[model samples]
Target: MVISGPRGTKDMLPESSCRWHYVEQMVRDLCRLYAYQEIRTPIFEHTELFLRGIGETTDVVSKEMYTFTDKGKRSITLRPENTASVVRSFLENKLYAEPQPVKLYYMGPMFRYDRPQAGRLRQFHQFGIEAIGAAGPTIDAEIILLATDFFQKLGLNELTLLINSVGCPQCRPIYRDKLQAFLHDKLDGLCEDCQSRFERNPMRILDCKNENCQTLSHGAPHMTECLCDECQGQFLGLQTLLQAAGITFTLDPRLVRGLDYYTKTAFEIQYPPLGAQSAICGGGRYDGLVEECGGQPTPGIGFAIGLERVLLALEKQQLLPDFKTGIDVYIAPIGDKGKTLAFQLLHQLRRSGLSCDMDMMNRSIKAQLKRANKYPARYVIIIGDEEVDQEKVMVKNMDSGEQCMLALQDVQSMIAGEMDN
Candidate 1:
């Protein structure tokens, strides 16, 4: 019997890994340009952290989280999302004590027991940024701009940027009442999830993806209509700043974040061509998350991008880069003496910044050359008994079918120069 890999987890083979590397490189470069430092937290944390920070009613905590008891009899969970963990890190490290707004970014695998699909997986990766300790609408604008700029940089310009204000604690009650009143009669029509949410968090019903639920939730009161003075101003200010920055967006009254902590300025960017699961990135400001997590009240905003979905979008748009695969040079040796010298030259070439591969099996020179072409080596260095005796090797350019004799010591310099061309 052949044992198979785990479910909902796909191996990142080399070809896919190359593309992932390119995407990650761009992430690091952009983070540097934005002056946002990188932070990495444990892949798992105390289950209570997310339970308190993400809210008990949220799907992440209630349904999807991978929770279990450790040997110590403490409940631990694999992080389904990162914002709550990032906040916990911020508080534990006393980052707020040093800075007013702490800007940080992270990239790593997150676990969620979700049904595997084209771009959705139980074990998926996310690239996120959390700008903590800032309350100004400008910070909100910056977060949005940064996300859009990253997509644009990756040649993903055909995106729908949707923005909304979920309102704050002061005014949310007003909207919640109106929404509940509107949904009171439609409770039986909504999905079971939306029905349960009506009492605990009616606002979340607006975010339901079920068509029937969406229909029931439509025409329900919008948070924007009942925003408090401060929330209203910040929302309007964010719009103005976004316009000044030349980023156009649609106002979605129903755009509530999936997370319970999101207070204001909820937004999601979608690649319409991706069909229903079009959201490649989404996030918003969570002003009360710090206080909810036992830290002093602090305002924060951030976003997380689903990397697999981003890759899917890139594939759909034909924007993925063509990554070349092959070694720089392959060294094939002949006889015992030639093999000894070939091994020495292989290390020498590699030390000089050349990707060189040599024959490990004591195969015939003809067989070695065949395998060399499989690596599709750009250049092949053949060292025979004659050449080894003369302290020289025969070099062949695989592309141009050119051959020449070069001193063994000059192999590194020649290959390095040829690569530069």
Candidate 2:
């Protein structure tokens, strides 16, 4: 039987890879502009990291993680998300001692054992950024602005920015109690997962996707109503700063993100065209994550954008850039002497930074031209015994059908010049 890629994983063909490259370049350029240095971590880590950092009650740790015991009798897991690993890196490397706020970004594949869908995959890529040790509301506004700037630059204008504050540890306990009291009577109506979360983490019920759960929790207490003085001040300050930066956002009281570590600020950027799973980017402040990961107390905030989902949105909206898929020149030789000259010229053109290819099969001039056309080379260089003897070649502009005879050495310069035009 022929082998195939795992389910929920995709093989990116050349055409699809071009789009990936374009998006990746844009992300790198944006990260550079924002002064977020790139950080790469291992694909897997100790299983306890996610449980402690992401919380045992979270879906990622409780249900979705790809975890197993290795030969060393140690439990290891492929990261379903990167924030936990990033926090571990920040602590293990002592990045805290070097700077007050460490700004970092990462791009790579993340794994999870999930049921496949349009935008969600078991193995997917994410472009994410984290600003650690930053405690002010200004940084929160900056992070939100960064997300908006990326979508706008990509010509994705139909995005809605939803912001909320899921009160910090100081006030969250009181809100959790109020929320539990409100939800106690509706326990039977909630989903089984949410019913269990009632006593453990009632706040997560607000983030449930089940229609029945959403409907039952609608009238339950909102975190905003129970926010303490400090959280309220931070939320108001974030709104003011966001307005001053001309970033529009809607206050969503039910937007308690599906992460345990998120505190104070939680925001998600949504593209409405993608039904059901509309969030393309989501993140917020986790002031206590560093401490949870065994590092000193550090205030941090970050966001992750699913690259596959972003690509899907871009393609759906017809916003992807037109990418060239052909080589610069195809060298077609008609005779033995022409073949030798063409082979030498092929390498020369390539060394000069031109994308050039030559026919390996000994085919007739007619067949060679056909292959050249199929290659869709911008220019075709035809070599024959006569041209080889004269040390000149016939270069045809494939698109315009304009043929010109030039010195073998001049072919490279001519193609470069034409490309500029």
Q: Estimate each model's TM-score.
A: 0.95, 0.94
Model 1 lDDT on a 0 to 1 scale: 0.91
* lDDT tens digits by residue: candidate 2, 1-421: 9999898899889999999999888888988888889999999999999999999977788899999999999999999999999999999999998776899999999998989999989999999989999898988988888888888889999899999999998999999889988888899999999998888778778889999999999888899999999889989999999999988899998787777899999999999989976899999999999999988889999999999999999999999988976788999999889988999999999999999999999988788788888878998899998898899999999999999899987888888998998
Error of 2 at 407 (Å): 3.2
lDDT value, candidate 2, whole model:
0.91
lDDT at 18 for candidate 2?
A: 96
Cα lDDT tens digits, model 1, 1-421, are: 9988777888999999998999999999999988899999999999999999999877888899999999999999999999999999999999988766899999999999877788888899999999999998999999899899999999997899999999998999888888888998999999998788889888778889899998877777788989999999999999999999999999988877878899888999998888777899999999999999999899999999999999999988899988978888899998888989898888988887788899999889899889888888999999998998899999999999898999877877887787788
Per-candidate Cα lDDT values, in order, are 0.91, 0.91
lDDT of 2 at 267: 95
How much RMSD separates candidate 2 from the native structure?
1.9
